[model samples]
Target: MATSTNGAPSMFSKSNYTWMLIGAVVIALGMFLMSGGKSADPNVFNRDAVYSTTRITVAPIIIFIGLAIEIYAIFKRSSPEKK
Candidate 1:
């Protein structure tokens, strides 16, 4: 929608907000999978398994960062404050 004569666009637009929420959830799930929901085992001796676990261990932190970025984008797109 176009901005009102006063110059700021509506803050309640559904598209941007909806996409932001969807993106956050997708990121969370992706991170969970990356960390290995049911397949991760620390005791496995195979080289590939060991490497996978190592990557899995770092998934949460990466997810947190992704969440932060998504939130930041939402805030950045917020309507300008009226004076």
Candidate 2:
């Protein structure tokens, strides 16, 4: 639904920007998940907290998903504006 009136075509549509925003939010959520795992005592290390499935496995997956979304956003082509 976006065609530049002038000769040049717009690089991205509103939909593309929306997807990019979603992707960025997903990435931030993944980072937030990875950032946690603080132990109560600094000296004593809690292996479980450090190696939890959410941090090691899930977060990276989430981040990758976000990256994929970002890639999609970048590559997505705008549909031709209907008459």
Candidate 3:
């Protein structure tokens, strides 16, 4: 059995970390999309801006997809490559 210099195996491979990073970026993007629906005027209310499809529908779907990717990344098994 192979072991590191400290005699402990790494919990995650490089690819796993990459996937996790990608998932995190996706989640951030989703959150960003959900934002920016505010009206410039304090007294004026814009229903369309607040209820836009991108913010109300697309953003939530993107967030859910990102969460799913993160979950998959956490459970994914890494197989060592043969040299």
Best by TM-score: 3
Top candidate when judged by lDDT against the true structure: 2
Pick by lDDT: 2 or 3, better one: 2
What is candidate 3's CA lDDT for residue 45? 89
Give candidate 1 misplaced runs (Cα > 4 Å).
1-12, 37-43, 53-69, 76-83
| lDDT (Cα, 0-100) at 3 in candidate 1 | 62
Off by over 4 Å in 2: 1-8
Judging by lDDT, tell me the better candidate of 1 and 2. Answer: 2
Query: What lDDT tens digits, residue by residue, belong to model 1 across residues 1-83?
Result: 43666978665455556767776886777566575334455555565643675455566666776687677656655445456
lDDT (C-alpha, whole model) for all candidates: 0.61, 0.92, 0.85
lDDT of 1: 0.61
lDDT of 2 by residue, 1-83 (tens): 57567967778898899999999999999999999778888999999999999999999999999999999998998888778
Clashing pairs in 3: none
- Provide the TM-score for each candidate, comma-separated: 0.39, 0.85, 0.87
Residue-pair clashes per candidate: 0, 0, 0
lDDT of 3 by residue, 1-83 (tens): 23457978877777777888988999999999999977889899899999999999999999998898888887888887566
* Residue 64 in candidate 3, Cα distance off native in Å: 0.7
